[model samples]
Target: MTFIPIAIYWIIALWGLFSRRPVLVYLFFLSLPFGSFAVVPPALTGGLTFVPTPMTAMLMVGRTFLDPTILMRAISSALDVRRLGLLTGFIVTALVSTVFMPRIFANRVMVIPVRGDVSTAAPLFPTTQNISQMAYLLISFATVIMFSQILKNARMQQTVLLALTWASALTVATGMLDFASQYLPVAPLLDPFRTATYALLVDVELTTGKRVVGLMPEASSFGSLCLSLLCLLYFMRRAIDHDRVRAFYAPVLCALLIAFAWLSTSSATYLGLAAFFAMAALEWIMRFLDSRYNLLRKRYLKAEFAAAALAVVAVAFIMLLHPAILENVSMMVDRMVFQKTETSSFEERNMWTYVSLNALVETWGLGVGIGGTRASNSAVAAISNVGVIGGIFYFGFIIQSLLRSAPPDDKRGQVLIVALRYAFVPTFLVGLLIGTTSDFGAFGAFRYGMLTAIGVTGLYHSSRMRQRRIAVSPESA
Candidate 1:
């Protein structure tokens, strides 16, 4: 049954590969969330695991190379050569370390795990797994760059966002169905193939029985993808021209995504949710203050004050009836946030961090190798796997890109860019706990790459627009 979607996907993908119209390629990008079940058969391709997203990325990169003009234009418009050089240096350093680093350092073992306990162990040097990881990273980087070039104008950007919004809506609907299937006897008939795929890919023990894995490999992964889409939708809403139907569906989709994240029972999702709401609240306060002072509207001010008072009263009332009324809330907070620190999972991550630090010290900050240690944290992984020199280039490239992609004076674009930048704060902080910079297979990396490309492309267009405005009105400037 899973073969059905896989077959249809290949049909479309092949058409896209051969067609002159770019719409098919855009459709392929938007449909990546559905690719979890579109896996290639292990018997073929020498037992190499292949998914549609990465396969499509490889095709796109090949297409770019086929047209040197497109590749050169994209590089010139979307990238700063200096930053590109730094990125190249980082990649080269990793390659060099993989070749030169020792296989065994005092009998220490380096394991590269894809999911759960399934992993490949090697010594300090790069194994086949490490090389595969490097390939994934390069593919991901090329994919983002190609998409950024393709989505140059405002119309293209809007098209991509609209496609993304629809895709997210579908994903949320599927997740809700998955959750309902747990209780409904006839739910299997609604999504038979997806249900089967979930059974095949999901680790039942880790999901805690109630969490919905959706179309992703696990509940946590689905939650991460949802969180990322939510952030994108929130920012893109401000930049795109509004439609009544889209406006109506946007909030409903957000509500569904939030519910799905909560039901996934991932602590990382909870933390991200907390951070998002905090930023939203802060933005709301700033807007309210700005309106109050600039517009000087007494009615609006009075309404705002009344709302604040009501919130205060509600909190006080809840506190007064705390023991019985808030027991469930307190218990949830304890389980999701507080008590998590005492769990074995937290201890394991701590142990990984300690080991990574020791590796860094032992190697004199030169790193062990590309896949030498399992740090479970991006910053630690950078130091331990890539060494200090590579880490500097790696982090430096990201920071420089963010700085260079500052939005121009367009109010809507500025607001969107600012929000997107703030959204990255929580994601980056979370990565320090359980992600790597070069983890190409994860949805988080995909989201990060997409966001970065959007910022850079938006800034490029915004700068051009600003220049035109200046040229038109020299006296005003």
Candidate 2:
């Protein structure tokens, strides 16, 4: 049964490799739902489950090196001295922290380790977990670089959007399967894919009801995955090249993703939803205020405004007729989000962050290494594990990536930049509360890489355009 997933993965890999164009992007996004499926057994990888995303990323990295132009373009995206310097320093510091710092501070600090019995904080020491996590971090970073190079072309950008739309649909399909599996017996079919080394909490239920985990290990993972897709599809819709996809398919997928995310009953996802809507509202407000924007057309504004007004009227009418319905929703929100802090799960997560942060202080901000400590917060996890110096370098690199200037004349590229930025915030916010590891997942790496790639390509094109204009100018003669 397990062979089914492995066979499909290899077939896709071979197809991607032989293809003339970069099909890896399509394969990467499409393979994300198989998160629970380890292509290689844990026993072979020393109890570390290797999933499809990372495996595809490895293929991408190989592709990046195989083509000289691709390698150069990837490097050129970070050619800026400050960006390059920060990235290098981050890599160096993180390597040192992973290899040496834990041994130096062995037994001196208590931390929630990447692996082992993490019910409580344990004494920090060098372990295979550190090496494994560092390896993951490096792979994620390399994936980012590889994506940046591949995504520079406008055609490739459209291809990615199409891939995302299909992937979003698949995500919805998986959630539906998960939801119906409770009543039906088809969940056994999904079992073949749930062969990860770690514990699988797929069937867990929250007070609200069944937590829809989809094909992931837990509700949180599934919910956050939905949230990420929701953000990308919703925010990036205007920039989608295909009219049908942008108008119909994208909207449907976005709606389904939101529904699945809510059904997951994950507090982290709820927070992310709130963050995403807030950003969306802000975008609408901006669009309403200014009509000359690059991506978001004013044509959609009337429908959106009309929808908002209709929704308001309907809500008011519903409240007047059946106030109990409103109360039920409020209670659900309170149960899923507002009262989350009182739960034991929240307490344990809070402690993970607290202890990991204290471990940072214990190591004098040199960090306990990449996998040395665990935290519920992504920021704290990154800073605590990498220490203040590495954090500075890492964050600087991130900021540099996110703040890349779009080409002034390139509307599609500018819209893409806006979409990526707005899409990133929800994921970032959700990760702050429930993220377990410092290493941003493959999806995150891809987004970051795309951001840099878009910006760099825009700059290069704009520069060339300017040079062409100058060459034709009479002043040059």
The best candidate in terms of TM-score: 2
TM-scores for all predictions = 0.79, 0.94
- Candidate 1, residue 199: the lDDT equals 30
Error of 2 at 307 (Å): 3.1
lDDT of 2 by residue, 436-475 (tens): 8878878778787777777753455577778989999999
Clashes of each: 0, 0
Residue lDDT tens for model 1, 33-132:
5535545654564545566667777776677557888788656644464325566567778777655653545355444333334233333544555665
- Over 4 Å off, model 2: 76-79, 82-85, 291-299, 314-323, 456-469
Score candidate 1 by lDDT: 0.61
